[model samples]
Target chain A: MDLVLIQLLNGVQYGLLIFLAASGLTLVFGIMGVINLSHGSFYMLGAYGALTLTQFTGDIFLSLALGVPLAFVFGFIIEWLFIRHLYDRDHLQQVLLTFALILIFNEAQKILWGSYPHSVPVPGYLQGGIKISQFLSYPYYRVAVAAFCVALALAMMFVIQKTRIGRIIRAGESNREMVEALGIDSRLLFRFVFASGAALAATAGIVAAPLESVYPGIGEPVLIISFVVVVIGGIGSIKGAFVGAILIGVADALGKVYFPAFSSSVVYALMAAVLIARPGGLFGRAA
Target chain B: MHNKSRITRRDALKMAGVGAAAAAFPFARPAISQGAPLRVGLLLPYSGTFAALGDGITNAMDLYVKQQGGKLAGRTIEWVKVDDESAPPKATELTSKLVQGEKVDVLIGTVHSGVAMAMAKIAREAGIPTLIPNAGANVLTRAQCAKNIFRTSFGNSQPGVATGIAMIKAGIKTAVTYSWGYAAGEESVAGFKESFVAGGGKIIKELTLPFPNVEFQAGLAEIASLKPQAVYSFYAGGGALKYMQDYAAAGLKSSIQLWGPGFLTDGVEKAAGAAGEGVKTALHYVESLDNAENKKFRADYNAAFKRFPDVYAVQGWDTTQLLDVGLKAVGGDIKKQDDLYKAMRAAKFNSPRGPFRLSAAQNPIHNFYLRELKGGENVYLGVAAADVSDPTTGCNLA
Candidate 1:
């Protein structure tokens, strides 16, 4: 019973982290009608950025505080320079450009940091474990990260559901032309959304940095899994992404424990099961 | 003035003609006969995750050459490099480019086992002198063993075999074996099981995840529930660092002992920091080996490279040392293939990893040291297994 509980917590923690990444991807793909393959690079950038910032500032939280804004600016520049031109192009072109961006970012990371793996220290206060049983105790840092993710998720929900910007975003998602006809520039809106998505992904990276240890190609796995999460959650539905991310996290964690041999494929198996039942994803609009 | 100018022009033309003839004379003779630079093809990952390992190997090999007055066995070394990208699919093409295209006399490689396997197949078929510096695929020196191929590094199972012996001696009677489900990992576990089971120890369980995956939460939770006496694992680079951190974080570090081959804490010691404390590992080389050769090598390498050398660098240094022995025996005539192979097979020299030589399978037979992580360094505890030779399983070196 204790084992199951701990595994569930592990799955939930992992799922929350994945949701942070997947939520950004779902937003960009659902609202902008853009296939952004380089979304994971933002996560990589955040982690690397955290590594550098923490080195200089000597604080992980401060690094996150600074990193999110910088990532937003970086994303704003990227959308303006490249993604803006890609808006009218086909998915193939978007994939090509973003794929190229992945390669470019990977190379840039290599040039700047080399190929050595690096670690950021967890702050001293959140260092030890919170005892649950005689043998099993959860790390305080992990619990803190989960709490932060919950808070962030709630804030995101509040902004998307209750605010004027959220109304504009929902309206833009449904009908961009109508939103533009209402005298609001949809282009500026999209750029903000894209930048916000980048910031969210970066936030995940900064928090995950101490745990995962920053390394080359770190973004690639997260990117692939986030895409899965987005697809499973219904490309444009934040609620769907949340449920899907949790499903994958729990399924993946439990699978590793129970079906050790087939653990790697368990997530894909879950996706297949989901797709078989709902072709449009759990919350996707009927096409 | 006209006469003097004409004479000077004629003299300059004469000198140019002589210089051109002197350069052309070497090309006129048959290549590889004598007095030509020995072309060594470096088929290693110059990019990607293994780039640092490649750089370390290349630097140490060059340092060795430099230490030998920039020549080995009376032949100047000429390096032909091709970045394998740590991709096995491209290994054949890259190896062909080095072997047939550049016509390199010696081939040295490689960090990834898959890439090394492909390189080994090509080298065996082509009958080229190949020295593997880092990759530890057991098949290289086992079923696929060849006279032309030699490994300065351990087989995939060698260090684990040593670790198993150390664990049994340390009174760990029940343990769990954990690793990524790959050839290297499976072989490592098998090696550990061999000695551990032989020493009257029982393996409680074996757990594995897919290769290169850093998710260890579920695995750690299971480990805590099982509550084994110790946990043996095989992981390297970033994955190793994360595993150590996770193992410590999961609160299992205080209860269950963690052990593995030296790679667990080898390169990522500083990054692993406090999480890596008291973890025991068995490896052929530790940074603090407490030998004169290792002491001098460390000092010299730090002087040259501005960093302490790791196991990969030691393997790189030993690759050159083995090459030197073979070349010296054949008097630098690489065309003397049979004699060169014989000399290399008989090679015995003091290496940074301690006394190194080839087993009949042509893999390194050396001491595996049991080291503990203390203060961000692999402190040498003692020799876990001395002059250990890998069992030449399925080898038929005809």
Candidate 2:
């Protein structure tokens, strides 16, 4: 029971981190119709930025404070300069271009930080385990990260469901032409969503840096998982992304623990099962 | 002045001759029969994750060559470089390019087992004197050992076999094996199981995760539940950093004694920081190995690279020495393939790690040290196995 519970918590913690990265990707994909493969680059940039900032500042909060906004600004610049042009382009072109961006980002980082893997220090206050029961205790950092993710998820839901901007984003997702016809300029909306999504991925990167360590190509695995969550959650749907991310997180954690032989293939098997049944994703609309 | 004003046929012919010689210099042949520079092809990753390791090997190899006044085996050295990229699928293509296109006299590679295996196959077929500086898959020395191939590095099993012996000697009654599910991991674990069981230790469980994955909560939870006397793990580089941190984070540091192959704490020991303290590992080379050669190696490497040399660099340093023996014995005539092989097999020398020589399988037979991390570096504990030789069952060089 303790094993299951602790692993369940592990699954949820992993899920929340994935959601932070995938939510932005799903929003960009759903509304903009631009398949931005470079979303993972933003996550990588966030961790790198945070790591550098932390190295200089020696404070986690300060590093994240400077890093998250830096990622946002970087995202905004990228969207304005390059992503805007890619909106009307085909997926193949977008993939090729973004794949090139991945290479560029990796090389640029190597030049900046060298290829050596680096680590971020957890704050002394948040760096211990919390006893949950006689048999079980969990790391405070993980629990704290999970809590922060949950709160962030709620805040995102409230923003997308209640605000005027949320309405614009929703309308943009359902029908971009109609949203434009209704005098809602989606160009600005896309730029906002794209930048915000990049920021979220950065935020996740900052949070995850302590757990995963910062390295070149660190964003790649998370990026792949984010894609899985976004596809599973139904692209562009925050609710679906949340559900899908947690499911994958738990499934992956449990799979690794219980099924050593087939653990690597389990996530893909989940994707296949979802695809066969829905052909889109669990919460994804039919293409 | 009057003579300069006239265009002389002899002067023009002299100038043309010089120009032609200069132009033909790069493509010119005939130095092979003499003691000209031997072309050594280096097939190692220069890009991607393994790039750092590859650079280390290259640096050590260069350092060794420099120490010998830019010559090895009485022949001046010429290096041909190619990036293996640590991709196994591209191994054959890369090796073929080096052996066939570059026409290198000697082939040296590589950091990945899968790629090394492919390079080994090509080197075997071509009868080229091949040196593997660092990958440690057992099959290269066992089933796939070649007459022309030599591994200056330890096999995957050597350290694990040492670890198993260490564990039993330490009186760990029951243990669990946890590792990444890959060839290196599986082979290391297999070696551990062999010695551990032979030493009358009972293994409670064996756990594994896919390669390069860091999420170890579930696996940790299982370890906590089982509460084995000890746990043996095998992971390297960035993955090692996370595992050490997670293992400590889970509060297993105080409870379950964690033992692993030396790579678990090698290059990434600093990154692991406090979490790595007191963790024991078995390996062929440790940074703090006390010897005159190791002292010089560390000091020279620190001066050259501005950092303490790691295991890979040490392995690379030994590779040049291993090759020098062969080349020196054959009088720089690498084309004397049989002679080169025989000389390399019989070559004995004091390495940075200690006394080193090849087993019948052409793999290193040397002391494996039991080391512990203290103050963020590996401190040599003791020798777990001395003059430990490979089983070399399937290899039939005779």
Candidate 3:
């Protein structure tokens, strides 16, 4: 029973981290109507950025403070330079362009960092675990990450659902022309949304550095998993990403525990089942 | 008397000419003169995941050639590098290009076992003398053994068997094995099981996760529930780092002893840091091994590369030594395939690790050291198995 409970917590924790990454991807797709294949590269860049900043700053928080904004600016610049030209283009063009960005980002990272794996040190306060039962204890840092991500998700949900910008984003998602007709420059909003999405991925990267090894191609796995989450959650829905992430995470965790041999395929199997049952996603709107 | 001496000299010259003709005609080479530079094809990864290892190994190889005054066996070596990229699907195609296209005199590679297998098959059929410095797929020396193929590294089972023997002797009766589901991982566990079961130890369970997956918490939870006395795992690179960190984080570090192939702790020690403490592993080489050769190697390597040499570097360095032995034996005449193979087969010399020799199967017979991670470094504990050679079970080299 305790094992079940601890693994559940683990599942939720992992789900929340994936959601942090996928939320940006979903938002960019939904709000900007741009398929950003290099979304995961933002996550990779975030970790690499944190690794570099942490060395100079000697504090995780300071590194994050600088790293996230740097990612935001980098994303903003990428939008103005390359992605802006693709907004009116077809999905095939968007995919090819974004895919090119992934290669560029991967190669650039290799040039900057070399191909060795690097680790981010967990700070002093988050070192120990919180004991849940006599035999089970989960890492305090992981729980902290889960809690923090949940809060961030809630904050994002509040902004998307309540604020004027939220209404514009919603309107833009439903009909970009109508939103632009209302005197709001959809282009500027898109730039903001794209950059903000990149920041979210960067934040996920920073928090996850200590848990996972930071290296070349680290983004690829997360990118693939996040795509699964996005598809299952319904591409543009923040709630869908959250629910989908948690479901996938918990299912993956339980799957490994019960079915060790087939654990690797469990998440994909979940996606297949969800696709068959829902046709869209759990929270995704019918196209 | 002068005329008789001239006649004898002429006779001796005639005999020498006849002998030279006999030797050179069959060998397909005139002499080991300063001919065209020897084309040494390097089928190693230059990019992707194994790039750093490839770079280290490449540097070590260059160091050896440099040490030999820019030549091996009096022939200047010219390197034709093709990035193996550590991709198995491309291994055969890439290897064929190196052999068929470049027409390299010798072939040296590679880090991944899958890639090595492909390269081995092609090299064997083509009769290209190839030295594998790192890949340890056991089958290369055993079932897939070839007369021209040689391995400087240990078979995947050597360290596994060594660790198993050590563990059973140390009274680790019940253990659980965890590994990525792949050939290398399976081979590692099988090797351990062979010696462990024979030595009267019980493996309570064997758990395998998918290849390239880092999520190990569920497995750890199962391990905690089972409460095995010890755990043996086979994972390398980033996954190894994460596994070690998770093993410690899961709080099983103090309870169940952690053991693995040395790769689990060797390269990732610095990144793993405190979490990797107290983990025991077995391998053919350790960084802190105490020996004159190791000392000199470490010193020279540090001077050349500006960093400490790891196991891959040692394997790369030894590959050149292996090449040198063969080349010198045949006086740089690589075309004399039989003589070259004989020279390589007969070489027994001290290496940076220790004294090692090629077995009848052309695999290294070297000592395996049991090592413990103390203070973030692999401190050599003891020699687990001395002069261990792969049994080469299914090989029929004869």
Candidate 4:
């Protein structure tokens, strides 16, 4: 029973992490009608950024602080320099271009950091396990990750429903053509949205590095799962990404504990089930 | 600028061979056993995920050539190095290239068991003597064992069997085998089970985690549910660090002893810091082995690489020495496949891990020792084998 409880927490923790990564991808793909395969590469950059900063400063919080803004800036620069031009292009082109970006990101990282997986430490205070019960304990870092993602989700809900920028984002998503006719710089807005999406991905990478360990192709698997989350949630819907992440996470957690052999298939099975039921995903809309 | 040593046709040919080997396939030739420079191909992944160890293996082979009066027998041993990319398809294509195009007399070096198995088939079909340094899939020397293939390094069974014996000797009853659910993992666990049952030890659970794709914490929780006295896992690469960290974090470190194959001290494990410390492992070789060969090897490696050689590097070096003992004895006449095979089978070399015997199954019956990490160094605790050998190889030599 204690073991189950611990695995349940593990499910929630991993689910929250998935949400943080998938939300941005879903938004960009759903809103702009662009499939950004490079989204995971941005996350990888963010992790390397944080790792580099921590090496220099010896402070996790400070590195994350630097990492977050830098991720945003880097994403903005990439969107402006490469992705902004790709907005109106076909999704196939977007995929090809972004796939190229994955290679670029991997090579760039190798040039900057070499090919070794850099280990990131959880802050000393948060490194130990916290006993939740007599036989059950959880790592503080995992709990922190859950709490952090939960707080991020709340902040996202607020930004989408209660803010003018959120209104602009929503308006732009609903009708890109109409929003452009209203004198809003859709070009600049696209750059902003792309950058923001990139920032979110990087944030996930930075926070998860302590558990995942930052490596060259670390973003590839997460990118695949985020796509699964996006498809299951209704592309472009924050709420959709959230639901998809939790569903996938729960399935994955249970699969590992029970059907150890077919555990990997469980995540895909959940995706297939969601596709069959919802057709367009929970929060997704038809073209 | 046109000095013969500096710029020559030989250099261009060498460079072309390397460049072609790197890219541009379709260079595979037939089994041409015409008296060439006794070309010995050391096919390793030099520019892939396994490059860390591959580079070391290449260097070790080079060192062996240097020791052999810079030549093999009367001929200057022409080494044809090719990258396998750790992919079986690439390995298959490349193995054909090495055998057919490069006309390599002997084939050596592989880090991935999958690639090794693929290469083993190709080499055996071409009637080439293939000696593996450190790819530990038992099937390579078992069900699919090729007649032409020989292994010098320890197989997957060593770790599992040694750890199993160690567990029984230490009075552990109910143990759990946690391993990556693949050939390598299965071999280790099977070996462990065989040895464990022989010693009257009982295993309650066998948990197989996916390789390079496991959530260590979730695995840990599942393990805790088993409530076994000890947990033995055979995991490698980045997974080792995460397993050790999560095992400790999940509080399993206090209750169940964590043990596995010797990948706990890989180069990637070094970055794991204190997380990997105290994780018990079964190793074929350790830096702590008290021997003159190892002492010289350690000093030379440290001086060259400016770091202590890990399992990958050490295995590569030892493989070169292992090959040298056999290749030189037959005067590198690998064109006589039977002659070379006979010579190597009768071959025994001094190594840091002590002497090993090549079983009839083309696999080595080797020593296994229980080891642990002490400040980033593998410290051997006890010898699991006193002239240890394997009796379970299923290789069909007929």
DockQ of all candidate complexes: 0.32, 0.29, 0.21, 0.33
lDDT of 2 at B391: 86
lDDT tens per residue, model 2, A1-287 = 56788788888888899999999999988888888888898888888787878878887778778888888888889889888888877899989988888888876776667555667888789876976444335778888888889999999999999999998989888888999898877888888988998999999988888888776678888889888888788888999999999999989888887787898888888988888888778777887
lDDT of 3 by residue, B259-280 (tens): 9889898667788889999999
The candidate that wins on lDDT is: 1
Arranged by lDDT with the best first, the candidates are: 1, 3, 2, 4
What TM-score number comes out for model 4? 0.88
Residue pairs in clash, model 1: none
TM-score of each predicted structure versus truth: 0.91, 0.92, 0.91, 0.88
TM-score of chain B of each: 0.90, 0.91, 0.90, 0.85
Best candidate, TM-score-wise?
2
lDDT of 2: 0.85
lDDT tens digits by residue: candidate 4, A1-287: 57677777788789999898898898788777889999988888877787778788786778878888888888889887888788768878898989999987875665566544557877888877887544335888888889999999999989988998888889999998899999998888887788889989999988888887666567877899999999888988999899889988888888888898998889899889988888899877753
Q: Measured by C-alpha RMSD in angstroms, how accurate is candidate 4?
A: 5.0
Q: After aligning candidate 1 to the native by TM-score, how far in Å is the CA of B227 from where it should be?
A: 1.0
Task: Compose the digit string of candidate 1's lDDT tens values, residues A37-133.
Answer: 9999999999999999999989899999999999999999999999999888899999999999998998677667766678899999999888876
Error (Å) of candidate 4 at residue A66 is 1.1
Question: For every candidate, how close is chain A to the native chain A in TM-score?
Answer: 0.98, 0.95, 0.96, 0.96
